[model samples]
Target: MARPVTNAAFEALLHAAGYGNAHAAFARQLNHAGRNYGTWRYDAASVYWWLRGRRPAEHVQATMAETLARKLGRSVAVLELGFGAGEGTGTSIYPASAGQAIDAAERLWTTLAKHIRPPVSGTFDSGKALQAALGWRYDLPDKTVSRNGRQPVTTGDIQSLYALADHFTDLDRRHGGGSPHTRALMADFLVRQVALMLRGNYTDVVGRDLLRAAATLSGQLAFMSYDAGDHATAQHHTTVALRLAKAADDRLHGAHLLANLAAQAVHLGHARDAARLAEAAIDGAGRAPAAVLARLYTTAATAYGQSGERRACQVALAKAERALDRTGLSVGPRWVNYFGPAHLAGAALRCLGDLHLYTQALRHAPDAITLSSQNARTRALHTALIATIHARAGDTDAACDWGRKLARHAVGVHSARVEQRVRELTAMLSPQQALPQVSEVLYALSTVPAAT
Candidate 1:
C-alpha cells in the first residue's frame, strides 16, 4: 500500500527536490503576491494537507491551481473551481481527464526543476535541474507513487543525454571547464536522439515535444563550451539548439539561443556579428515570454556596448526595461524567473558601466543591490560591480566598503571570473592610492582567499 502523505512528508519531498526554501518563498508570495508577483496567494500548510488526499479548506481549493500555475508559468483562476482559497472540504477542481492531468504534472515538474538548484554535493549535484527536467518528461514520480505502476519512455538516447549533462556540469565545476570532446559528445547525442525521435514511433506531439527538450539540452551543452572559450564547439551546439527550437516550433527558445550565439561572437571579438545576431534575437523575441524578451534585449545592449554604439546600447537598455515592465503584470516562465527586475537592472547597469557610462550605470546600482538574491557568488559579483562604480565616481570609502564585502563573500567559491574582476578593480585603484580607502582596498585584495 502507498504510504499516507503527511505535511512533513510533503515538505521533505520538496526538500529532496531542492525546494528547501520554497515554503519561505511561498509565504513571502502569499504575504505580498499582489505587490510583488502580481497575483493571489495561498496558505502553505493547508495546501500541503490538500495534496495529502484530504480535502482542502473551502476557501483554499484554488490553492492547488495558484501553486501549480506559478509552477507552470501562467496566471490561473483556480478559486473558481467550486471553492475559495481555503475550502478543504470539497471535491477536486483538478481536471478529471488523465491527459489533462499528465500535462499539468509535466508542467509542474518542469517549472519546479527550473527553479530548484541542481544538487551539487556528494558524487554530483543532487536534484540537478537537467536531471529533474529529464525526469519530468521520462520519469513519473507521482504516477509511480499514486498508481503503483512504472512507465519509461522509449528514447534511451535522450535519457543518456540528461545523464551526460549532469556529469558534464560536475566536471565543469571541478575542472573549471568542460573538454571540447565532452561537449561535442553531448551535442551529437542530443542531435542524433532528436533526429531518431522525430522519425520513430512517436507522433508529432511526442516527437516535437522531445525535440524541444533535446534542443534545450544541446544549447546548454554548447554554451558550456562557449564559456570554456571553445567558440567553434559552441557554434556547433548553438546550431543544434536553433534547429531543435524550430522543430519544436518554439520561437522564444530560438531567439534566446541566438542571443547566446551573439554573446559568443562578442567574446570572440566579432563585434559586428555579435550586434547583428543580438538585433535579430530581439526582433524575433516578440513571441517569447517576457523574461526572455528582457534577456534578449539585455544581450543586444551588451553587443551594442562591445561595438561602441552608445546610442544603440541606450536604446537596447530602454527596450530591456520595457520588457521587464511587461513582466510586472504577468508571471514569467520557470526557466526565466531568475531573470527578474533586479537581474534586468544589474545586467543593463553592468553593460553600461563596461561602456564607461558611469553616471547612467549608477542610477541602476541600488536596484541591483536590492533586487539580487542572497547567493554568495551573485552577491560578490553585484557588490564588486557596485564598488567599481563607486571607485570610478571618486567615492573611495564607499568603494572600499563594498569591495571588501565582495572579497569576503567571494571567499571559498570556485569562480575565477569573480576573482579576475576583483583584480581588475584593484588595478583601477592605482590612481587613487593616496586615499586611505584605496589602501584599505589594497589590503583587502591581499587577503582575498584563493578559490577552493
Candidate 2:
C-alpha cells in the first residue's frame, strides 16, 4: 500500500464526526500523556484503507483530529489529511448502472458461499493494543467468540444487503417488536448475510461502512430476540453485532449493542450482569452527545435499580440528567434524536415507580405521560405505572379502572414486558373491594400469565 495519501477523504470523515486536525492532535495527546506514540501513528497501509473510506477505531479517529486541534489552537478536519478521488483506473465497487446493483448482489452472495465459519472458543482477553485499536476494553471477559456457520462475502452485495436489512426493519416495526418467529428468522438471515460480508472482497473503506450499517441492524435483531424471550438467540445475535461493530471500528454502535445486552440481562433477572453491561456501554459511548448519553445512563440507572443498588441507581440517574443537559449544548446524532427530555423523564419516572418511590415517581409521571410520543409500547408501560401507583395508594377503584384500561390496550400487542406489567397491576387489585372495576380487571387478568 502507498503512504496514506487520502488526506481529503480522511478530513471529510473527521468533519462528519465533528473534529479537526484529529490525527495530529491525537499524536500530540499521546506525547503529552507519555503514552505509546505508535498508536497515534498512521501507516501507509492504514492510510490506504482510510483513503478508500475505511475508518480507524472510532475513538482513535475522533481523537486524532481533536488532538491536533488542541495543539494548533485551531481546527482541521480528519478527512483533509491526504485523499483524492478515484483516478478511474480500477473496477467500481459501486455499480455504474442500475442493472449492476442486482448483478452485484447475486455475485456477492455467490462468492460468499465458500468461506468457513470462524471456530468457537472460550472467551479471551484481547490485549491493550488490540483493545485500543478496537477502542474498547473491559476488566472482565464475559463474551463468547463462536461461529454460526455463515457463507462468504463478495463485492456488490451491499445493495442487496441494504434492501434486505431495510425490509426486515420494516417488518419488525409493523408486525410488532421481534416476535419469536421474527427473531428466529432474523438470526438465520444474519448468520447467512454476515458470513458473506465477512468473506466477500471489498475496498477497506467500503467494507468498514457496510459493516457499521450491518452492526446496527444486527443489534436491533438481537433486541428482537430478547423481546421474544429467546435469550440464547439474543446472545448469539449480540456477539455477532459486537464482531461487526469491531470490524467497522465504530464505538457508538458497539456501545448500543452492549446496552441491548444489558437490557436483556435485566429482563432475565440478572440485574448485576445488566449493570456491568450498562457500565461498558457508557465507557464505549465516551463523549457522545447529550441525547445519546442520557439514553445510555438512563438505561444504566434502570439496571442499577434492578440489581437493588439504590445509591448506584440514583447516581446513574443523575448522570443521565447531566447528559440530557448536553442536548441543549450540542447537536445530537440522528440515531439518538428520539431521546429527549421527555423520554428521559418518562423512563426515570417509571423506574422510580418501579422502585416504589411513589411520590417522586408521581412527580415525573405527568410530564413523561405528556411528553410521550406515539410509541404504543411506551404508552402502555406508562399506563401500567399509573395503575401501580393507584394500587399502592390503596385507591382500589382508581387502580382497577386504570388496570382494565391497560389490559385492554395491551391486547394483540406482542410484548411480554407489557403483559407482565398488566399482570402486576392485576395482582395488586384488592379482592376485598369487590368493586366492578376490580372484577373487570380480574377478568382481563384471567387470560394473561399469573406471574407477570
Candidate 3:
C-alpha cells in the first residue's frame, strides 16, 4: 500500500480562511453549512482525518469549500482545497463560468479522444448539482459572446454543427451510448472539429447561435454518458451544456438541461435533489413552448414521485397533460421535437410506477412501446418497466410475458439504463424461478451481455 500524503493545500486554505490551526472551528462551520443538505455530524476528529490525507465524502467536501468560500470572501473550489479534481482541471461536476465551462468541455473531449479515461470521483454531489441548477435559474446571460481566434466562423459552419448534432442524436437514440467505440468517436469529433469552431472568430450574433448549437451537442453527449452509466461525466457535460445555454441566452435549453440533471439525480437515488432541480427548471422556464413546458413538468412529476410526494406528482402530471393539450398551439425548437403524446405517456408511466400505482402505470406502457418502436433503448426500458410493474403487482405470467418482450427489444442495444431496468425486472421476478415462464424469461435475459 502507498503511504498517504498530507493535504498541504487544505491546511493552507484552512489557515487563510481564518481558522488557522483550529480544526474545531472549521468543523463547526462545515456542520452548519451542511444543515441544508441534511443532518451532518462532524467534529475536529473528522477535520484531522482530512488533514491526514483521507478524503471526505463528496457532499462534505462541497460543504467544506462552500463554508471556506464564505469566510474568505472568494470562491474556493474543492480542487483548490486539495480534496479532488477542480472545475479548472475538468473533473468538477460544474464550472464556475461560461468561459471555464467551455475550457472544461474541451479538456474532457481531448482526454477522451486520446482513449484516456478522465478522473471520476465515483460519487455524486447532490449539493453541487443543486447549486448548479440554482445558478442556471438565476444567472444573468452573458453580455457578449464575440471571440477572435485562428479562423473566422461562418453561418455555414454553424449549420454544419447543427447537422452534426442531429446525426449524433439520431445515432444515440438508435444504438445507445454504451459502446466505447461510439463514445470515442463522439469525443474525437468534438476535439478535432467542434473545438476549433468554438475557438474561431465570430460576432455576438453568430456566437450566440454557435453557442446554442454547441450546447445541443454537449447536451447530447451528456445524455449519452448517462445512458452509458458514467454519472460523473454526464454531470460535467450537463453543467457545461447549461453554461453554454446561459451564454447563448437560451433559457429554454437551460431548462431542458436542468431536467436532464434531475433525471440523473433520480437515477442515483437522490430524490430530494432531483425534485429541487426539476422545480428550478420549471420555475426558470419563462414563456417556453408548450412542448418544453410539458417536458419540464413531466420531469418534475418523476422526481416528485420518487420523493414519495403523491399529490405533487399528480399536480405535475396534470400540468404536463395541460401542456400537451396545448402543444399544437406553437412550434418548439427542433431539439425538443421528440416530445409528444408518446413521450408524455412514458414519463407518466415512470412517475406512476415509482409511486407504486401499477395499474395506472401499465395503462401508459402500450403507447410508450408502440410510439418508441424505432428507438430500441426506449422500447427496452418501457418493456422492463411494464414487466416490473406486473411482477410487483403479483402477476407472474404477465410479468414474464413483458419480460420476454424486453428480452427481444434489449438485444443489440448498448444502454446501461436499459440494462438497469432489466436487472430490476429480473430481481423482482427472481423469487418465482421455479415457474416455467419465470425460468424462461430469466434464461432469455441471461443471454444478454452486461452493458459496457
Candidate 4:
C-alpha cells in the first residue's frame, strides 16, 4: 500500500498548513464537505488509505481541494494540490502565480526531504532551454505580492538571510557534500526560517530582497544535492531557484544559476543542453563582470568538448580565456567571486579530460590544482584529474602516487563528489590493482566512509 503513489504531496500540504495529523484534518474536511460516505464512518485510516492512491469518491476530491484551498488562502486546483495522477512524462512546473510557485516548491521539497524520486523533468531541445534562459530577462509579474501577513518583515530580517547564505556557502566550499545532515540543515533552515518569512508581511522592495535570499539558498541546495549524486532532487531545487531568480529580477544571479546548470548538464552527458543553457545565460546577462562572463563561456566549452565538436570547443575555450584576461580589474557579486583564471584552468582541464586528451589535461590540470587553494573540494577533483591522466598514460607508478594524494585529501573532506573522484581514480587504476602502490592507495580509499 505504501509502494504505489503515496499521497506525500497532499500530506505535505496538510502539514505545511498546520493541520497536525491526517486523522482529524481529513475527517473534518470530509465532514465540512458533507461527505459522510453512506455507511462509512470516515476515520484517519480511511484518510491514510485515500493518501495511498485510493481514489476518494468524486465529491470528496472536491472537498479535499476546497479544504486545502482555504488553508493555503488560494484557489487550489486538484492537480495543483498534487492530487494529480502520480507519474508520467512532461510534468510542467512553470507556475502561473506566486502562490502556485510556492506550492510547487513546497511539494518538491517535501518529496526530496522524504527521499522520494521526483518525476523526470520533461526534456527540452536546445531551443526551448535557450528560450527559457533568455526569457528570464523579460519583465514578469511580481511573485512576492503578499503585502499582508501576521508579522512585519524588515530589512534586517532579509540581511540575516544574506548572512546565512555567506555562512552556508563557505561550509559547502570547505567541507563538500559528504554529510547529508549539513545539507539537510540548510534545507531545514529554508523551510523553517525562509519559508516562514515568505509568509510574513513586507513592502515590495523588502519582498524582492527576501526572494533573492531564497533564490540563493535554493541554488545552494541544488548544488549540494547534485554533489551528493541526487540529480533528480537537484533538478527540482534548481527549477525553484530559477523561478525565484526570475521573480526577484536578479539577472546576474540568474545568469550564474543558468551557467551552473550548464556545467551540470555537461557533467550529466547532456552536451547540447549545456551549450544551449550557456548561450541562454549569456544572452540575458546584461553586461555582467568579466569573471561571470568567463564562467559562461568556460561551461560552453565543456559542453562542446563532450560532444566532440573540437573546433567549437576551442572557440569557446579561447573566448573563455580572453574573458578571464579581463577579469583582473572587475568586481562582481559574491556568487561569482570564486571565478578567475584558476577556475578557467579547471574548466579547461575538465574539457580536455572529457575529451580524453590526457597529455593536454596533465599540462594544465596541475596549474588548476595549484590555483584552487581557496576551494578544497575542487582542488581534490583537479588532483584526481592529474592522476587520471597519469593512469591513462600507463604511468601506473605516478598514477598510484597521485592517487594516494587524492585519497588523502578525500579522507579529510566532507564531499561525496570528491570521493567519487577517488572512485574514478580507482577505476582508472584497476588494471594495475596488484601493484603495491596502487593497492596501497586502494586500501587508503577503503577507509574513507562511503556516502549513502
For model 1, the stretches where C-alpha displacement exceeds 4 angstroms are 1-201, 228-232, 267-269, 328-332, 371-376, 430-440, 443-452
Best by TM-score: 3
Please write out the lDDT profile of model 1 over residues 247-289, one tens digit for every residue.
5566677677777777766555666677777776766656666
Ranking by TM-score: 3, 4, 2, 1
Q: Candidate 4: global Cα-lDDT?
A: 0.71
- Residue-wise lDDT of candidate 3 within 59-101, one digit each (tens)? 4565687799999999866567787653444354556566776
Per-residue error for 247 in candidate 1, Å, reads 2.3
Could you give candidate 2's per-residue lDDT for residues 120-168 as a string of tens digits?
2122112211222233343222132222223334446666766676676
User: What TM-score quantifies how close candidate 4 is to the native fold?
Assistant: 0.77
Candidate 4, which segments miss by more than 4 Å at Cα? 1-92, 112-146, 371-374
Compose the digit string of candidate 4's lDDT tens values, residues 213-283: 88898888888877777665666567667777777778888888888778777767889888888887888
Candidate 2 regions exceeding 4 Å error are 1-175, 184-194, 370-374, 430-433, 445-452
Better of 1 and 4 by TM-score: 4
- Tell me which of candidates 1 and 3 scores higher on TM-score: 3
Q: What ranking emerges by lDDT with the best candidate at the front? A: 3, 4, 2, 1
TM-score, per-candidate, Cα-based: 0.55, 0.61, 0.80, 0.77
Error of 1 at 104 (Å): 33
RMSD of each: 19.9, 20.0, 12.4, 8.6
